[model samples]
Target: MSTHRILIAGFGGQGVQFAGRLLAHVGMYVGKEVSYLSSYGPEMRGGTSNCSVQISDKFIASPLVLEPTELVVMNGPSLEKFEKTVVPGGRIYIDSSIVAKPAVRSDIEPHPIPATALAEEMGLGRLANVIFCGYLIKKLDLCPLSALPAILKEVVSAKRPELLEGNLQALALGFSM
Candidate 1:
């Protein structure tokens, strides 16, 4: 498999880390090399936060993504901050529900999704991250869509397995939208 660098960006508490974790887990589950790291400071919860994950069939040289192949912009400011760094032909997914007026350059492929709105519509106000993840999995074609339900099941608990079910529903919803 080719190396794929993915960046998930937003303010802290938006589940940026969780999304990255899921990606890393899926990569490893498929026997691919993966690195997942989240940037954190005292201000992370109130200020900016982001995570980087690299998935590859070969050895990865760096964990820091200087020119990511895919950027998941979970907020407007994040898109502004990272847009210039994305390489040409790279894919960008924006959470249009929370981010307004996401700017664009000519080279990147931007796929906007109303993640927060979708979560709220499903009565899952805290699941905007899940929605975005689903959309990313679909649009980026990160892995086979069949792998997503299993990924969610792997991350969620038996005590609340419906949460995983809901997440799978959200992923399917996002994928189809």
Candidate 2:
């Protein structure tokens, strides 16, 4: 069985763990073995946060991920911290709004998307993480687009039902890009 490990890192409010949870849920819904682990600094909103997710066709050996197959970084600090931990030939997705500098590695492919700027334009600036999720799914063929609506709906909060449409829109916009 093959396992695909993903790492997502960003500031505390960037929804790094949320994006990781989405991927892990999608993987499980598709019948794959999945594990997710999240870590963050004690500084709360502005502090660093990250999550590791592993999806596999067989039982997962561990939840920890030291070298990821793909890395999603939403800020300059995150990029600097996690860039070297990606495996050679791995893929890295950077939020161009916060990460202006490009990765120095030649072996990995880099995708720089202006997530925050685009989300602000959509009147949902906080949905940047959802946008990144859409981009990652589309770029990596992680899951079917048709599966997102149901899963998203299921996971979204009952009190914040209005955000679901915005999240869907953000996801579609990112996928189109």
Q: Which candidate wins on TM-score?
A: 2
Query: Model 1 lDDT vs. the true structure?
Result: 0.81
> TM-scores, in order shown?
0.88, 0.92
Query: Candidate 1 — worst ten consecutive residues by lDDT sum?
Result: 133-142
Off by over 4 Å in 2: 40-46
lDDT of 1 by residue, 59-174 (tens): 98989887888998888788888888898899888888888876568788888878888888887767777777777666656777788887777777768876886777777777
Clashing pairs in 1: none
